[model samples]
Target: MLTKLLITDDAAFMRMTLKRIVTSAGYDVVGEAANGQEAVDLYKELNPDIVTMDITMPTMDGIEALQEIKKTDPNAKVIMCSAMGQQAKIVEAIQHGALDFIVKPFDHSRIIEALKKASDR
Candidate 1:
């Protein structure tokens, strides 16, 4: 089955870019969110197979959202996305139950690879 996805990013361009890449790669994008709080809300509503989450956002931030989602659904599949060198946050995300972390500016292969890994879990 094609994986369903929720994309959460504060930047409109990033969301659009990821949507395009994910769609082209054959995953169904079930929802989109502009912040961590929204991501959590949408995750509950959509319950997608995977989520791609940006580290920094207006309301909650990705780490917090990842924790919230994990709390609600221990098996939630989330992949953290950060800019080049947010190493500490990435590690925190993984420790907090994120399945994988991907560095941006968005690589198609990396996104797909992360999705595949998340789906496997």
Candidate 2:
């Protein structure tokens, strides 16, 4: 079966861009969220195979959402997305059980590679 993915970003453009990339790469675009809270809610409902989460957002940030998801499902596969210079937050996400991270504006190859790695684990 195709890998299922939930994409979370505060920017609608980013979510749309990511959806295009993941769908073209053969992943099923299960859902998209404009913020971390929505991401968490969709996660519970969809149970996607992986999540691409942006680190900065209103109504809850990616790290908090990642933590919440991990609390509910320790094995949840999350790949954090962050702008350059957010190294500390990225590190924290990794420590919180994120499978991997991709820098933005995202590179197509890196996004695919991160998804592949997360799905493999």
Candidate 3:
């Protein structure tokens, strides 16, 4: 089965880019959210197999949303995405239960690889 995915990013362009990448890589783009709060809500509603989350967003940050999702479902598969130089935030996300992370601007191979790995887990 194609892995179901929920993509969360405040930027429309970022979300569109990721949606294209993941869908072309053969995963289903189940949902998209423009902010962390929306992400949290969609996650519950969609219960996608995995999530691609952005670190910086209005309403709530990725780390907070990650924590919220993990709180409701410990096995939630979340892969954080951030621009270069957000190592500290990435580490905190991992600590909060992110399955992995993808650094932006995204690499096509890396995004597919991360989704594959997260789906396998």
Per-model TM-score versus the true fold: 0.97, 0.98, 0.98
Candidate 3: list runs displaced more than 4 Å: none
lDDT of 2: 0.95
- TM-score of candidate 1 relative to the true fold: 0.97
Who is ahead in lDDT, 2 or 3? 2
Q: In candidate 3, what are the lDDT values of residues 1-121, reduced to their tens digit?
A: 8889999999999999999988888889989999999999999999999999999999999999999999889999999999999999999999899989999998999998898899889
Q: Rank the candidates by lDDT, best first.
A: 2, 3, 1
Model 2 lDDT per residue over 55-108, tens place? 999999999999999988999999999999999999999999998999999899
Residue pairs that clash (backbone atoms under 3 angstroms), model 1: none
RMSD of every candidate to native, in Å, equals: 0.7, 0.5, 0.6
**Over the full model, what C-alpha lDDT does candidate 1 score relative to the true structure?**
0.93
1-121: candidate 1 lDDT, tens digit per residue: 8899999999999999999999999999999999999999999999999999999999899999999999999999999999988999999898999889888888889888889888888
Q: Roughly what TM-score does model 3 have, to 2 decimal places?
A: 0.98
Candidate models: Cα lDDT each: 0.93, 0.95, 0.93
